[model samples]
Every structure is written in C-alpha cells, then in structure tokens.
Target: MKKQNSLFARKPAKSPKSKASMDYPETLEIIGLSHEARGIAKHNGKTIFVTGALTGETVRYEISKKHRRFDEAECVEVITPSPNRVEPFCQYYGQCGGCDLQHLEHSEQIKAKESLVLDQLQRLGKFNPESTTPPLSGSDQEYRRSCRIGINQLMRDGTPIIGFRRRGSSKLLQVDNCPILINPINKILGKLKAVLSEADSCKEITHAELSMGDQQGAMTLRIKKPLPESLSSSLQKLAEDNEFRLYFDNGQQINAFGDEADLSYQLEKSETQIGFKPGDFIQVNASVNTQMINRAMDWLDLKDNDRVLDLFSGVGNFSLPLATKAGSVIGVEGVEDMVQRAQNNAKQAGLNNCEFYRADLSKDLKALPWYKQGFSKILIDPPRTGALEVIKQLEQHQCDQILYVSCNPSALARDGAELIRQGYKASKFCVMDMFPHTSHVESLVLFEK
Candidate 1:
C-alpha cells in the first residue's frame, strides 16, 4: 500500500495561541483558480482560497474566514504578477461586486471560463466531450442590455443610494456609471440619480429594473407605496427625455406612466421579435445571444419536417426561431404569463405552427399532453438549477438530438451525466461568454444518440 505523505497527515488540534496567529498575512504561490475565479493555494496540508489573486503568481493574503476543510483569504499584495494581468478599467472594479475578472486580460478570461466548464464536466460529470469548438464571445464591455440597480433609501444622508451591492457586503455601492451597461442606460444614470435625490417619494423606492431592446429602452421602478403625482411627472419627463418607457410596480400591478411601449429584442438571423416585460428574464448579452441561437439552429440542422420541443422557453425566444425552420415547435415554460407572452409573440410573428404550454418541469411531466408527442429534437435552457428532472424524463421520447444551454456548470454536469447514462454521447461543446468579466459560466452542449 502507498504510504500517505506527512504533509497531508491529520495534525493535532491547535492551541488558542496558534489559532490567533493564523490571522497574520502569509505568502504563497497561487497554483490554480477556483470556479469563482479565486486563487488556490495550499499551506500546511490545508487548502487556501485567496481572492483577487491569479495563478502562477506569489501573493500575500490575509485570512478572512477559516473553515474546517479550507481557509478563505483576500490577497493584500502581489509579490509577482502574471503577464496576463491587466489594469482594470472600471473605477469601481475592486469595490463593486458586479465583475470578477476585470483585472485579467479579456482573452485570458475566455480561456478561464472554458477551462472551468471543461473541469466541471470532467470532475463532476465524469465524462469528456468528443470535441470543443471555439468559444462564442462578443464585446466584453457595454454589452449588458439589462440590469437591476439596487436602492438604499437610508444611506448617504437621506439621499437614495443607487447602484449595485458592494463586494462581499450587503451595503450598496453608489456608482455614477457602469461600463458593462449599454451606452444609453449608462448615459442616463446620473440624470436618474439626480431626479431621485430631489423626489419626495424617493424613500419609498426600493430598486429599479432596466432593460433595453433593439428599438427601445424600458425602466420599471419597484416601490413600497404609490408615488406622488409630482414624482411621477418628473419620472415621466425623464423617461420622455431619455426616449425610454417608464413603469411603476407597487407589489401588485405594473402601471405605465404615459403610453404603453412595446419592449422587445430582435433575433436577426431568424428575423424574429421577442417581447418581454420588465422583470421577465432575458439574456443581457445581445450579441452572444444572437450567436448562441444561430449556432443552435445550425447544430440541430433543423429540417422542414422536424418536430422540436423547447423546454423552459421564455417569451418564445427560441421557440419562435425554431418554428421558422421546423415543421412544428412546442414551447414549455413554468410561468403562465410567459406562456401567454410566448403565444402572443408567436401570433405576432405569424408562426401558427408554434405553441406554448405552462408546465412545472421539476415535477412529473409524463401526464402532460405534450409528452405524448414524438419530438425529433429537444432544446433545454434551464435555470441555474439545471434540468436533471427533465433530462431524466426525456428517456421516454427517444430524441435524436438534444441541445442544452446552461448558465450553471455544476448543474449542467449533473444533468449531462444523466443524459450520458441514457445512451446519449456529447458531440459538440462550447462555452458562451454571456456575462463578461464575471465568474458566471454559460455553455452549450449537443448530445446525439
């Protein structure tokens, strides 16, 4: 039998003095990066995860929190920096929790995400793809079409603090502009902040959801109470001046200020328009989303007689596009409003072959009427929790092809393993840079029988 190394041997419990000394700064070489983009190091047989550090660099980190299996730390100083490190452009790069890989070069960031996805598949799924295509990426800045801005009414001397949350804290970090947001939204941030500062009902405001479509922009403010007429007029004027639609939600119904403007994005390849409400989920990266959909269509090799089943379809984002090529397309979503919205979108697109249904995908779906159909191709864009339950149920359909778009790699790996067990082989795999500068991983995998 192989003897265990003393370096990894279990050590006796440390005294109170030794435990206190652990708070001191320690220097170590960063050997790897965690899924969250933190540096990985080992000290005295215990693993250490250091934030703000990169691989192949020597860093001095201070322990922030200690755990039984490992220690958490924050890099205070870099003794040696890697060549891939770049100066972050955003002024609030380190202070804001919106981005994680701003300091790393953009190309290196893509490679890291791809590596992370592959690592998850191998380590968690216990499988490897036959081939990995080049990663799908777009502009790393000013690409976010939507954002949720936090509001702290109690902060900054009664003036509403508007921005994202601070790094590792619930406290709000006031930001004048975020580079990742689209140019129009960034341009109006200061103006909006000024308007809120002067408004009497600003304290009643909680947060704001901003979304930009191909032709128009929309903002929805979540409020605790009804806004006064004066504040409402000011907001309406602001939206008019900015050429964006404004709406107010008081935890019940959403009311528009002036005319109800249609908020929708265009899928250029398919020539399809998808309309969505303010709080509805849509891909923030427009370029990547277009590319992702186009690639999915190409990978599926849609035929005129193909019957496609789109799971977790949102506002017919994919179902409408698929209907343009396939003979028939069925969309299943968990939200009733989204199902209705999708049906309306399909009707507006003049695609009668596409249908939308509301179903709880996590529960047993065998009893659903749509389950009886023999689908030739299946596409699932599940949430971060993934589609393990749906994948398990798919075995009864004998689908010829399955395309999965995932935002969470761990969940994808768990579901991918199930698909593999059901006699599906992963043929094509690629990472999508959906959220640039962040540790979030979005990927696409095509499985074939």
Candidate 2:
C-alpha cells in the first residue's frame, strides 16, 4: 500500500446518501431569524434555514433544498412555538407567496424588519446610525392599494385560476380573496375570477394588475395576444359593472377599453393629487406611502431658500411635495415617459417652480444640465439596487442634506457606507412598514454633511 502524504491526505470518507435519504425529517432548535424571515437552525454543524419556524422555537423540519454551505427546510411540525407566533388571518397564508411573515405576529414582524435593516448596515457597511427613530407603520391588513394577480388555466379543467404564486413554486395558488388587499380589490377578485372562467379567451391573459387610487380604480390585463371582440366587450362590461377603468396590454402598447378618468391619489399634507396611468409604478400601501412622504419632508427640513434635487423621481411623488416648500425643485428621472408625467403632474398641480428632467442616473451626472444648477438638498429614491453611483457624486454637489429612501436593506447598507466615506454622517434612520408581513424592508436615512 502506498503511504499517504499527510499534507494532501483526505480524511476517511463517510457513507454517501441519496438526495431523498438526506432529506429525512430532522429536529432542530431555532436560534434566530434571517433577513428573509426564515428561522435559523443548525444540523450536523451546518446552517439550516427553516421556513415557518420562529426564533427560539423547537421544530421538526424537512430539507427542501440542499446546498453546499447551507440547507433550506420547510417546517413540518412545531415542537414548541415562540410567543411571537400568531395565527395568520388569511385563508391562503401558507400557500400564497405574496406574504412571508404572516406566521409571525404583526408587531413582531415590524421589529424583525427593523432589526434586519440595522443588521445589514453593520454586517455589510460596517457602520451604524447615530440614532434611530421609532418605526413608522400603518394598518397590518387591508392596507395594500395595488396588486398583480397571476392568471393561469387549471390543468385538470380549463377553468381560470387566479391569485398569487404558490410559495417557492411557479404554480399558481387559487386565492379568491386576500386579506392584505384593500376591501375594494378583494371584493372584486371572486367576481373577476368568475368572469374569466366563463370567457373563452381567458387563457390569452397572463396576469392582471389591479390598482386603487383615492377616487378611482384601474385594472390592466396583460395578454399574449389581442382578445377577440366578444372577449374585449365582456371585459369592458365587467370593468363598467365594477366601476373601474379597464385596459389591455399586448406586450407593445396599452389600449383602453372605455373612457374613464385617470387614477389619482391624494397627498393631503401637500394638497396634491398625483394622477397616474394603470401601468405606472405607485406604492402598494397608500397610507404608508403618505406617511413616508410626510416623514421625508420633515426629515429634510425644507426651507424657502432651499433648492431641492429629487433623483429617480417618479411621477413627482416627492418633487411636487418638495416644490411646495422649497425655493425651486428639479426632478431627474431615467424614463422619458416618467419625466413627461412628472412635468404634467407639476403643471397640473400649478407648481411653476418644479422642473422635471430625463437623465441616466447610473452614469456620471456632472454633464447633466440640471447638475450645473446645484442643489442645497438632495432626495434619492432609487430602485432596489440602491444609489451607490449617486452617493459617489454627492461630495461634488456639496449638498447640506441627503435623504435616501431604500426598499432593499443590503443595497442601502452598501451605499450608506459610501456616503460615510464621503464625510457625511447618518443622522436619522427609521424603518417603514410599507410592506407588512413581508421580509421587504423600506427605510429612510438622513445624511447631513
């Protein structure tokens, strides 16, 4: 037998098990919760993530996915439940992928999200806020103003199945009602499903987006191809009966069925009504959106002489409000259509001081015409990717204040560190419960130079 070299020697190999055998049910002691709201546990010295398991609870779980470093599990039975665990009110809570933290109590859900933000800041950015404000939250249920309902035809029967996706799967979960949606949207779900099930061309639809504004509602159906005249008329009749605007989108352009007023939401504090088309991006939670805008305004401490720059501005959500208080406001957006919409919104709001510009924010913005004007304060509401590029250019602007609105905590933490490196100090940080019972963390950070 050849002598083994200790330097390159392999340890005694353990018996290999098949995938099915490796997934045998195992008991674990939940130790913590991940940023995604899954419970953390240890099995054979490896980390296991258990869904539907609360921290500090003993649970029986089965591995759903095995990875090299960690394993993902689905909680099969709760040996002991945490005090913070609560009964999810929605009938389709476990099945629907729309919500992740419904099993966790509402208040505890907020706490977990708050903790997630702070943890990400420390772990990724290696920085902490000077101070944190109390979390801003609204009603836990019936708070969602907009939602996209997935549509698919049942394999067994040709009937339409409507609702969100099943958890961790591409399959559709038939949900006639969702508790998180506002009453109006929930009330129409069953009726809409019934109508679609009866229509011969319902299979042409991929999904339907429902949006509710303060005064009106709109529904947009995404179709693979044009619907027949009969199907179009039936959908229009349904929209009329439901008192909502109806539109069909066939990959290229959106076409309205009947003449209905545009959808608009009220920002009572600023006395502004923002009108948007059905496909336009709007906050899903209306109340939380209002509160978030109010908080942003207060945190920025706008002054009559201040010139505000709102980056990633969408439909003048913050620009119009800032314009109402600042000397002059310049809104820059990447999408030309959104810039036009923002301009129209400003014009309709009768705010002559507000101007909207179209620019690619990811690239160096120094050459932009609006950059030469300079701003005393800047508000950034970039998408989930965060505003690292914008944060890098802030030192050149020499703005006194920078208010960042983030929907993704990891991205926020990364950019927050960049701001600190530029000599700005994080003054106030607060988590917003814009999406309750979900792992999504929305937050505001005020950085003062």
Candidate 3:
C-alpha cells in the first residue's frame, strides 16, 4: 500500500458518536424560559432547554445533553427572531456565563422577570398580590459596582485566561473587558491583566474580586500561597498606579496594600455610609439597590413611633435607613462580623436609634433576645434559600406590616405560602432589574397582617 501517515492520521476517522448525534440540528419554537434563563421548547413531547434562544423565537439548536424526559441544546441559528431580541453588546455574550439575557431587549427582560415573579408566586405560594407596582429599573449596562472574575492558571501561549467561566462548562474565556462593570472597573482590566501576567505569583491566583465604593475601588487576589517579594512589589505598584486597593488572600488571612482603607458606599436617601472589607457581601447594582431600599422604606410607611425589625440585614443597608424614620430599628443578621459592622456603621452615622444583633436566622429563633420584641413593622432581605424558619414565627411577633426582599422567586414563593398561612395577605409587589443582563429576579412584596 502507499505510505500511510502516522497511526492517528492513518484514516480520516468518523466524527465522535456524541458529536455526530449533536450535528443533526433541530428547529425549535421557544415558548418560555427555564429557571436558569434557558429557552424552553417542546419537541415530540420532549421538553428541550435551549440556550441563546429567546421566547417567541424559532431557532435551530444542537443537543448538548440528552436526558430521559428533557434535552439541553445550544441555539445554532435564529430562524425567526423575536421582536424583543436584540444584538448582544458583549462579544462573549453566548459564551460567557456572566450574562444570559443580553440578547433580549432590556425592557422585555424586566417584564419577563416580573412575569416570572408573579407566576412563581401563583404556582408555588398559591397567593397573588393585590397590585403589582411598576418595576424599579435603571441603566441597562455598566451598573455593577461589585463583581467576581475567575483566573485560569493554565497557560495558553504563555498567557492565562482571566474572566468568567464559560456557559455550562468550567472552561475560562479570556475577556479584554466586561461592559456590565462600571467605567472605572473596565478602565483597569487591561492594566490589571498585564500586572497579573507579569507577576511571578500569577499562577497561584485562583480568582480576583472587585467592589467599587463611591470614591475608591477594592481588588483582591485570592491566591494559593503568599506572593514572593518581587510579585508583591509589582502588585503594590499596580495598585498605586491604578488607584485601587489591592489585597492578597493566602487562604489563612488577607493582607491589604494600597490607599483603599476608607471604602464605603453611601445611601443617599438616608445619608448613611456603610463600610465593608474586601470580601464582604454587598449589592452589585448601586442605583437599583438604593431605589429598592427607598421603596421598602416607603412601603413600610415608617412613623416616628413605629419600631422596625430588619431580618437578615447586611451592614445596616436597610436598618440604618429605617432608623432614620422609625422610633428604633433592631437589625438581626446571621453573620457576627456583619452585625458588628452594622453596629459600627450605625454608630458612625450618629444614629443611636439602630442596634444590630447577630443571630443565625436559618436556625431556631425562640431563644434569641430580639425574638420577643414586638415591632410595628418588619423588613426581611433573605438570601436565595429564603427565611422559612423566620416566617414560621411571624405569627408570634404580630407585626402589622412586613416587606420581604428576595433575589429568588421560587424561594420567595415558598416563603410567601407560609406568610399567607400565618394570616398575612400580599398587598403590593415590585420587581427590580438589579442584575440587568441576567435572569436574577429581585422582587419585593409587602404583606399586611
């Protein structure tokens, strides 16, 4: 026979079986969105979840995962695009997991989120609000003040990818810049990448985090070990050059180096500034967060004589504001550090009316000192899992009004069901686009006893 190439190239082998199966694309009509923002389609009685496909659009999709009752797909072609669809601004739109609804119109995205909240409340909570207020929304882009980015130590052409994980995969995609971040953050990415690349300790970095306060920004390098002298000096110079607070977390403790110590975000409505460390949890979208907090306060209709209780309160974001209007505000948080920070913030603001106590809200509250306090109104801003145990004891407190802020609709619905059972009726509901291009739904509901 004629000379054959190496064994690997001996034959132009057939495509892998899984690849071949996915190569056969199917046309699908998207009708709804899954909880993860994937488009939902029905094909031959099997439900297909499609990424990059908008509702009311027909698209050609390739199967990525096939299960017994459902299949997962990635949209290949938009055969019929929805009117609400628009070209994505980011070049890495479909690939980056940071944003999912960038292709959909911003207005439509908020509407869809509002619809999702209402639908979940109806289905899971078996309750509906008496009225749905207009959604609180702001700029569709460049609104995030807090962000986290992953760093891939694996070298590609002697350079690592610094950005976010790819959609449905652990692989990292290198992004020059992210549009959702504020202008200051975007301005530093190029310089930040260069600094990381040149640093000898770059390979040890697991991720980078940034949070912008009103005057300054903080960046943290989560590393596997302490950086060498040379790398630390380089990072310090980079922070000084870019006017950012930089830190290195070597698993045990974090060491800061830069002029970022006075970092605080001011709540204009209440005129209170909340200080936080590099890794503390805070709201991402400043505008939406302020508006939402103001809305909650308005809904509570605080009076000088009304005592307010804030549950799951973080650094007095809502409690400090509530203290300005209510007789006294008692904030309960699960994290002791956060509770201490909230107390300090209240003290700094010269607001002696607000007090914070640490309590594991996810656990039983029967023995907690604040558990017995009867407040005229209450506010709860729970995490994704919601506050089931806290809601269960609401009947014992007998608060007249309660405003619940939730980032997950399903969790809110489950908690809402319990609230209704405890003799509370949903009154006003509001949704906000806290995360512009993502399916994250931030909703607030007011319940009256």
Which candidate ranks first by TM-score, i.e. highest? 1
- lDDT of predicted model 1: 0.86
The residue-by-residue lDDT of candidate 1 on 1-449, one tens digit each, is: 22111111122233233434764435779998889989899878888887888888887656667789998777767778878888788988878888988878999999988998999999999999999999999999999988988887764477778899988878899999999999878866767888887875487888888888877788888989888999888888887777688899889878888876578988875657899887788999999999999899989999999999999998988899899999999999999989999999999899999989999999998888888978999999999999998899999998999999999999999999999999999999999999999999899999999
Candidate 2 vs. true structure, TM-score: 0.93
Q: Is candidate 1 or candidate 2 better by lDDT?
A: 1
How far is 135's C-alpha from truth in model 1 (Å)?
Answer: 0.6
For model 3 the local lDDT of residue 48 reads 87
In angstroms, the error of model 3 at 270 is 4.0
Query: Model 3: per-residue lDDT, tens digit, 113-154?
Result: 898889999998899999999999999889998788888766
| Cα displacement (Å) at residue 410, model 1 | 0.4
lDDT of model 1 at position 263: 87
List where candidate 1 sits over 4 angstroms from the true fold.
1-20, 23-25
Note the residue pairs that clash in candidate 3.
Answer: none
lDDT of 2 at 187: 72
Which one is best on lDDT? 1
Tens digits of per-residue lDDT for model 2, 359-412: 888898887778988889999999998888877987888899999999999999
Candidate 1 TM-score, true structure as reference: 0.94
How does each model score on lDDT? 0.86, 0.84, 0.82
